[model samples]
Target chain A: MKIPKPTIKRLALYYRCLNRYREEGVNFVSSKDIAERLNLKPSQVRKDLSYFGEFGKRGLGYNVVKLVDELARIIGVNKVWNVAIIGAGNLGTALANYPGLLKHKFKVVALFDNDREKVGKKIAGIPVFHVGDLIRLTQELNIEICVIAVPELAAQRVAEIAEEAGVKGIVNFSPVKLRTSIPVEDVDITLSFETLAYNILKANPEMLKLIEEQ
Target chain B: MKIPKPTIKRLALYYRCLNRYREEGVNFVSSKDIAERLNLKPSQVRKDLSYFGEFGKRGLGYNVVKLVDELARIIGVNKVWNVAIIGAGNLGTALANYPGLLKHKFKVVALFDNDREKVGKKIAGIPVFHVGDLIRLTQELNIEICVIAVPELAAQRVAEIAEEAGVKGIVNFSPVKLRTSIPVEDVDITLSFETLAYNILKANPEMLKLIEEQ
Candidate 1:
């Protein structure tokens, strides 16, 4: 079945919500419970889940444990993915150390950078390899996912190299549009701040004038 | 006029697209040009731009410089916003050093941390203040936005404190959903990975069995 992009995102969210409930020792939760926690309507949650298959029962809502396992398999978090980060910059290093990825079964096995000073060093026990070795090491390490955290100008080239290295997917942190055959997810950090800024401006029109004067 | 959230995001994308054009010395561009670069439909671009007011002429495309200036005001990037990060861990430090924020006029003036060791240090020349001083420091520094980069357990509490400090909006990086009266933009780093994983699995169903076996 073809799932809408927003539904796919909400599926991941439902997965996380279910995991939290399972941890709290709750076995069953109605769609209303999930919707309230996520600030969405119960119908929206039920409809998104219905895209995959019938999940929640009529009266019992949904089985939290069963749904967690089902969503985990559906979202492909059931396996550990060998990952490589293409930049050894602060963002890359932070992602390398981020606990959330490993908690969800995505492991950072190696970090690639062009700087010789950083190439031989280790951060958080993950070895940093030279970018030139991406193709060879990616095969040896069986790296399936590559994280692009380089500068804007270097992002495209690095993504090309990762594709050449047979990486299955890319999670780009750069601010540039990358043209690659492989699947890529752009994490535009600055855009969120800009969106929040626009929301603030909309709420307080007076602030717009002050900002304009400055 | 009330703009849709996605349109607001696209406006930021358009702003960046135009900035790149301005840098490249491009003088004029049709909606098609911007749409092509952003991978959106031309009609979508024209419709989004039309929400604010008319910009394009009958035969002539938008004047790049003029549109860039107009978008700058509409999106509120014309003003500099003082930003505070509510955690001084790796993620917070990475955000503090990220050049993109400064490039987009969101300055990381200070970082708040509960760790006493991190509280006194500086990252990227931005001072680290104790979380205890969030209210005082927020007012003293005129911080308008707060980034929630704390661990999931501490995220909501930090957000409550930030709201109590009278910050305008929040850019949340935590996994939990935040309940606040102010506007919030979540930057869920792991959700992107999960979504990408789902896409990969959808394309390669055989991988599912292998993953399940593991």
Candidate 2:
């Protein structure tokens, strides 16, 4: 069954929410309970979860552990994925040390950079290698995902190289649109700022009008 | 007139796409040309742009520079915004040095941390202040947005403090759901990993079936 893109995103959210519930020792959660926590309607949660299978009981609700395990499998987070970041810059170094990626079972196995000075260093204990070694090291380390953290101009080339190296997908951090054949998920930092700016402006119509008039 | 959330996101994309065209010296673009670059239908681009105002002509398409300027005003990126990051960890530090933010006119004016060791330091030339001074410094610097890069447990507290400091909105990077009354744009890094994992699994159904059967 082909799930809607939004449903897939919500499944990820549900997985995280269920993990929190399990941590808090909550055994069962109704769609309403999950909805309330995520600020969604009860029916929306039920509809989204229903796309997978019927896990909720008539009165006992859905078992937190069971749903979490199911969603983890469905979202493919149950397996540990080897990841390589293709930049040793601040963004890449920070992502190398980010605890959330490891918590989600996406391990950063290597860092790649063209800079000679950073090629031999380690960020968060992960070894940094020159981009020239990407194809060889990717196969040696069994990396599945390559994170494109290089500058905007170099992003497409890095992505092409990662694809040629036979990585499964890419988590792109550059602002440019990549032309790779692999699945690319963009984490646009400027787009987030623009979104926040839009929301802030929406909250103040006078400011928006003033700016628009200018 | 209220805009759909997805349309607003696409507006930002269009702004970026238009800027790219401007940089390449492309003077005008039809909806078809814009849509082709963004991998969307021409009608979708036309409809999204129509929400704000008419910009395209019958034969000339849309003037790239004029459309870019118009979008800059409509998306509220016309003015510079002062931003404060409420964590001096790797993620926060990387965000401070991210060139994309300054390019989009969102300046990182301060970074906040509770650790005594990093309190007096600077990341990317942005001063790191103790969390105790968040309110004072936020007010003094006229900060409009606070980026929450703290850990999961501290995310809510940091968001509450940011709201109390009278910031307009938040760009939350933590995995937890914040309970603040202000607007928040969550940049869930782990969720991106999960999305990529799902796509990978979908692409290789045999691997997915083997894992699911386990």
Candidate 3:
């Protein structure tokens, strides 16, 4: 059975929440507690978990460690996946140094760039290679995922290179929309803020109208 | 008349798609065209749009410019929103320089950090201020939204400051899960990559099991 994309995303969130609970020495967590913490409804939590299988006992809450491990297994984050970043610029370098990626088992193995000066250099100890070597380096490093953090004009070309390199997935940070057969997850930071702005405006429709009239 | 969160997000995507279409001089777009470009179903596109009101003529499709303007207005992107970054780190500085935010009307008015050196510096011409003066500066600049890009340990504190400043919304880029009364939209870059990994692993379940056994 195919899982909804949103469900998959939520499973990752649930895993993160459970990890935090486990760290706090909380051994068990009720759906209600998880819901309240994540600002989700208890029914929504239960329904999302139901897709995987029965997890918790009727009376007792879920074992924090057990739930975290189960989610790790289900989300296939149990093993580290080699990741290659397509840009060696600010965003790409920042992502390369991101501690969360290593913690979550997404290892940055290589950085690719078209700039000759950046080539042979390292960002966060990850070697930077010319973009021309992307295909070769991807195979050499056994890279499974590619991150497109190049400029907007270069994003499409980099995405095509990653696709040609036979990458299994892509996490795009560029403003450009990439069209590729491999699954691409856009980390549009601006769009998230826009959504937040929309929510804020919705809550204050009068303010929104006032601004429009200005 | 509450719109689902997912639909609100999709509206942003639709607005973006319409922007691209308009740039290409495309005047009209059918739901199928929008759906196909966004990898969503035609019915889903129509359903998401129905939340606002009727759009597009039955036989003629939607006027691209009109649809773009409508979606922009609905998503509250028509006016500039004053934004402040709560960290002056690499990620925060990169975000400050990100052109996409300005394009979407989220103006980075200030950068807040505890570092004495960084506090007086400028990123992308936006002044960095001491986080201690967050509440005061927020009022002074009429800042509405705050972006949390601080480290994990500092995320919660930064969020509290933003909340105390009476910011309307927050876009958290840190790994930490912030607890606040104000609305927060997490742009967990790692979670996005993990979701991509999950989708890739799901497509190759045998490989996932093999990795699990290791």
Candidate 4:
């Protein structure tokens, strides 16, 4: 069952929101609510969910606990997980210390940094090690995922190292393009800004105003 | 100049790749390179770019610098823009401090945190303020957009605050419903994970077993 790209993205959000609804003891949710959270139309939400199966009630919406369980199972976060973040830059450190990753089936078990100063340091209790130790530590811990947050210049080399490390998958955040014999997906966190920047520049032609503000 | 959602997402990647080619003094790029980098079909890239305009030469690929400039213009990153991030949590701060933002139109001008301890602190040179100050600072600074990085519990409230601040759009990383007046749209960052997670889990019921290897 290959879900659409957009749908896959929504599943993460639904699961996250469903977890909250459960904690708050909210048992039901309307598509309208999910639509509102996602900034989509109610019809779109209903359509996306219907493609999976008829889970939400026509009037009552979705059950918080059941939806949470379903979404968790759907997103693979239901399972316990160990993750490895490659690179110890600002983005990598932030994700290594991210609170949400800890709550999911993911844990940043290992950190790899080329900077001698950064190695042996810790981000959110995850030990930073030399990139040379990637395969050795990865095999030892049976790390599941690798998050590449290195510079574009180092991305391909780091990815090759990660592939050799026996990582199950890669969550890439760099702007560089990397290829792997193994499954590797590039997700640029820079896109959010790129999108916003594009929209803003479209509305305003002169860049100097923004420059002057700074 | 409203790019489709999927195409809009890919433009950033194309922009980056084109920049690489231009930096390397490569003048032309075929759709093949774009497809290869993004893991999409060459025809798909051609079709997607076709919607924008025929920037590609008949035999040669797209002009590297020219295409990049066109895309930078289309996506609106040609200028400098200020963004306000609500919620000074790990994710919010991560986004505020995300690199390349200052270089692009996306610059974090204000950070809003409800925690008294965090309210006045500066993360990555972005000043943190109380949520109460969102409207005033946003209006004064003319924050072009807002990023919601608060917890799920406080996500909606923070979004409402941003909406009241008169932001035209939002990028919501929180997993809660956010309703807004006209002109406010949220780009949900978590959706991609959820959808992909759903597919991965469905394909491999036991994610742990599949992801784990001795």
lDDT of 4 at A44: 73
Top candidate when judged by lDDT against the true structure:
1
Docking class of 3: medium
- Name the lDDT value of residue A14 in candidate 4: 69
Q: How high is the TM-score of chain B in model 3? A: 0.92
> Mind giving the per-residue lDDT tens digits that candidate 3 earns over A1-214?
8776767888988998999899999988899999887767888889999899989887798989999999998888888999998888778888988988898999999999989999999899999999999898888889999998888898898889888988889998887768898888888777798789888887777878797788
True contacts kept of each: 0.83, 0.82, 0.83, 0.41
Best by DockQ: 3
Ranked by lDDT, the better of candidates 2 and 3 is: 2
Among all windows of ten consecutive residues in candidate 3 chain A, which has the lowest summed lDDT?
A1-10
Model 1 Cα lDDT, one tens digit per residue, B115-205: 8988789999999999999999889999999999888899899999999999999999887789999999998789899998998887777
Better of 1 and 3 by TM-score: 3
Question: What is the per-residue lDDT of model 4 for residues B50-79, given as tens digits with 9 covering 90 to 100?
Answer: 878899987888988889888876776766
User: What is the DockQ ranking, best to worst?
Assistant: 3, 2, 1, 4
Q: Rank the candidates by lDDT, best first.
A: 1, 2, 3, 4
Chain A only: TM-score per candidate: 0.93, 0.93, 0.93, 0.84
Tell me the lDDT of model 1 at B80.
Answer: 87
Residues A127-173 of candidate 1: C-alpha lDDT, one tens digit per residue: 99999999999999999999998888999999999999999999988
